[model samples]
Target: MEHPLGVQPQMGLFEGGADVAAAMRTRGLGALACLPDEALLNIMHELAPADLARLACSSRALWAFANHDELWKGFCLDQLEGRWDFQGCWQDTYLLGKQAKGFQPGSRKMRRAAGLQSDLLYTPWLCATCAIDPSWLEVENVDRRSGLSVAEFREQYEIPNKPVILTDVVTKWPAMKKWSRPYLKKAFKGGMTPACLPNCVVRRFDKTFCETAPQLAKDYTVPEVFSDDLFKLLCEARPDWRWLIAGPYKSGSGWHKDPNSTSAWNGVVSGRKKWILYPPHITPPGVRPSCDGADVASPVSIMEWFMSFYEHKASTRCESVGYTPAECILKEGEIMFVPRNWWHIVLNLDECVAVTQNFVSEVTLPHVLSHLRSRSPALVSGCAKEARSGLYDRFVKALKEHRPELLERVAAEEAAKKKRAQEQHKLAGLFKGPEDACPGVNLANGSSAANGSSANGASKPEASGSAAAAQNGTSAGGGFSFGFKL
Candidate 1:
């Protein structure tokens, strides 16, 4: 007989009463049914879903316990990382999960799912990618007890441009409880347009919900550490920069930096995401950037990129200190800080919903302003005009009102930068002509003579401490810095 859910029917535990009695007597134990209901339920809870279902067919006594909604509810909650509560019958949710996992590779229904190119459970790529673990992905975790104050965050992580997973930052967010699948589906009802990544290695569903949906703005607040979001103040011009990211299970984004050079923070409201990060200081060898800094040409997909770059070269390139990319999994209610110029790739472990924002703090504001002034003067000029003020004065005023000490820090840094520039200009005049330029001078120290041309007739990289500053805002061009992404 066919089972309704296609589940294998359970085997009979005691088809013959005499045999059951004989077995019990041989073991010198009473009948299993004689156990109390609480004990039976506890035992049933420990069984896997398949085994529990099989036990239901053994006898009428086990059938009642197996069908209990509480039993299945617990299973669903545990598997979902305790983020979702069953909205209706727990059996229905369990059956849905089971059916989702049951889809055969290349099945018609699986192929038709929007943005779902592969199943999380059945994909050969997922299995292979998760199998190989590399050592360089040693992600640093900073929790509440780490004493991660704003000053320390800037000095330790932000200024150095390193990735760190912040564990306790988003625990009190209103979105943690309010942003559910049902609520989001309703908010985005009639498919009120989302920015879809076209022909991307992984399907990414992005919608600029922060501007379109007023309700979301109320639900999601900026993290305290990144409260100085100058972009939000100027969002009227570049509305496309901010967005809400939602993708189905097995859907995610490819290798890319956050648009513009601004630093970003992504808070997962629910579900899980696997992040692969490459710091700006040490990128994988032979990574070719596309003309548009937004994308890259890779072997196949993001996962394949990792496999080919790290897994295949583990013996050589990966053995170097601080060479491995920072890899970590961000679960429900966790927020990740992605510093400017640091490249990252995201893959959803489940159907995921997250809120991400690009912001400029005092640590990064000078860089953002400098990038904007040079790269897109019109944009910077327009923002200042819109505020009915001068660009520098308005920014300074905003800083004074929100963070007075931060303003002082920016002023000090800018003064130091100007002095360095003047010194470099003075030194560059001393070394004129091809003869002086060709032999690369040791500019490792802060000297303009050290900026001599290389053997290939290209100018040697200067120790311009302001390079990071010049490319610190969200990008407005094909390449982020010097025709390269980051």
Candidate 2:
């Protein structure tokens, strides 16, 4: 029903202006205390951020409910659209004060000394001569014929949040075949430089590597390799990868998670690389130690932390406590599988040709969608004070009721699967090498062969070809594969 102001009563205030304000001060506490927990949450949800902050300050009971992480999480998810940049937040909230304390009158050397140093420990070895244009990269829509049907591929390969080798595409590009270590060094020596910020490039130590190469350049930009048509197609076909080619001397992209709520795959064709992975679920406790403890004072990026521990002489002691991070080296023709939501840092060991794509595959869409839906209330409420308070309360209730079981199940399943895989691998080692020496397989010539053949015949072949095609009949080649049994 419409209220006197022509708005629905539920959407409008029914009480008088002064009375409502007074009631908020006097009865608000009682209302918060007396309301059933769920209803109280619902009411808080109807309030705005200012009102929520006010409620938080009113009393210990309100404060407890207001400051509950569930409330802030929901507030963040809803209002911020899950795009809270930790670095940006740190800059605004903490770095300003830190920088101010160190400020002094003009001295270029001192100013340079005080500036934030690159915290990246492991840098990707890139061809030093190439230039990269950041503007050349754009998000793309999916194409139907690019190996896997977009939807089907997204289901099997993308959603499961595992990396896959994209064959045939870009393999014929000049960089894939020609951009080698020598070529990169020569280009850099000739004075090639990157055309834009945030572009990738290779750094070389010696002029000899540069003298032996062709297509020498000081730097390259995206405009040279990535055409508008190519960029548009990539953006359309694989909008998630955020595709960009590295310029000479630019390390493989710095360590960071893909922004689209999932993990990503970086497929290299001409170069070798190293990857350091930190399971997204793992969180280090206590204050993170600063790098060098004297010059660098801020918390280290997770990548710097892992690399420092990896390269340090005291590595054994770090590993003994299980603080040493997991690292993988991937070479050309090999695919590195990054699990969903894992934080990974990559270094290209040489001038490399690679395609990096982010995907939301079948296994991961539910989680991604749930994350998206959870942010809806924030958008619906705007940045109002009362509505925000209400949203926070609702979030706390949902956390109490829904999230714990899922977290526990995920943890248990991961533990069990790891244990089982280890056991199976150990058992399989006993039967390694020629079957002729395996007692079970060499029982008798005819008997062993006959029995083995029968056993092998009884089972199915390991599933091959595109995972998407295996699940559905659709193929990346725009054909279908069907099986017929008589």
Candidate 3:
């Protein structure tokens, strides 16, 4: 059709244009800029730190708005869990937080006290370490060839409290085939959802506040042996203990223990990782306890510090200390155990997708219980309160309902221990009596009736053997083993 104005619509053109214009009005800059400053900021509050950075670069107005300290302050409190003046620059503070998870220093002295060299610390020394000595660390690897059984796992790894990478454990999980960087990026909101990148070594995308990878809960399930997690039972209210960790190279956790002394298992669906573990007895060099003697803080990334130490081991002071660290190259379709209280560092070797859960099992129940009782009973999210006493009692009841035999066995063992302890106490006291010490001694008055008149008008005899020895000019020996005349 032709129009007099020479702007005639093509077939369905006017209708399509109306739809497109309406969509733009709802989604495009018109929609964004028309929003009030407060509403715009409220929308910006929903953005992740990385997205916020990108938004600032989008335009001058957004740059000014995103740079507001008030916005960053709220971000610090929400994302970082606390607020600190990073010299009145919330962006620096926010970026510092993204770099170092759980870093909030109120003062320079606080940073120093935390063993942090500076408020902002990141170094890429892992690549160098892998090049120089890839297998320098000493973590144990259990391949399919090892033929490890449940019994062997319990006795050697769980009971003895050690970490091991089991290659055959998760070979059948659907995630191994389905999860990939490209696939996930496409399926899960254009791969821009800032994952808990191990490169940053911080937990990312809290499901409590954000949605998750649609395929996570389906493709992966807890490994068979580790499915009986009591920590999860206690922390039934908290779903954050389990994490779907996905990130690019050089991203993983820092040198830290799993919260509340819970043991954990990590299964790699795809990609490889460098896992380093330190036993509870040996504190990794440069790891220091905070002021409370409870929490620990690190100055440098664990990998960097350990790498420097490994490179300088020949003439360095660490040679005198002589600590062996456990390291492993965890590959795809493999699972690893991180024992309770073990300090560990995980660095992704490549684009990685993994699942991990902090757990307490029958083996670690007692330790987890002890950890819980030591902390404040008020249930705060993510702290090991799930391992506490009152919560553990509830867990025990639940276990009794589902797995009564297991509870019965534990009860029987505890009863037997108590019986043995009581028997030992009686046996220890059996030989102790008044006659065993001083014969015929009076309790009411400190008088030996052996050589004095008793209350009943009877005289007890003194030691005649000693009296005879003295009369025979042989002094009764008391102090010295060798007889010497003084």
Q: What overall lDDT goes with each candidate model?
A: 0.54, 0.37, 0.55
Indicate the TM-score of model 3: 0.54
> TM-score: which is higher, 1 or 2?
1
State each model's C-alpha RMSD to the native: 17.9, 23.1, 22.6
Q: What is the TM-score of each candidate against the true structure?
A: 0.54, 0.32, 0.54
> Which digits, one per residue and each the tens of the lDDT, describe model 3 over residues 1-486?
221111212224354454543343244334485665457767877787678867766643455445555566667767765323244356667767676554554432210111111111113222222443455534454323245776777766776566777777688787777765555655565444434433332335334212455555677777666766765544355325777777656556777777665788888887788876655544566567553335667644545655655443232122124545666888888888887777677777777777888777777655554455444444223635444435545656666777677566566665776677678656645544565455544555644433365555564323233234333534321111112111
Alpha-carbon error at 357 in model 2, in Å?
A: 1.3
The order of the candidates by lDDT, greatest first, is: 3, 1, 2
Error of 1 at 445 (Å): 13
Model 1 scores what on Cα lDDT?
Answer: 0.54
Q: What TM-score quantifies how close candidate 2 is to the native fold? A: 0.32
Off by over 4 Å in 1: 1-147, 190-204, 211-213, 238-241, 290-295, 312-322, 374-418, 421-449, 461-486
Clash count per candidate: 5, 57, 8
lDDT of 1 by residue, 1-486 (tens): 222221221224444344443343233223655554457667878999889877766543345456555678678756643233233445556666556566333332211111111121112234332533445244534322233777767766666666666767666777788776556556656254222221111234354575556677888777677786665554354324456776655566776666546788888877788887665433354355543333556544555555556554222222243344567888887888888767677767766778787777655665655555443333342333354224545455555776677657666766776678688867765655545433434335433354455545565433222333324532222122231111
Q: How much is 462 displaced in model 2, in angstroms?
A: 34
Model 2, residue 134: what's the lDDT? 33
- RMSD in angstroms between candidate 1 and the native structure over all alpha carbons: 17.9
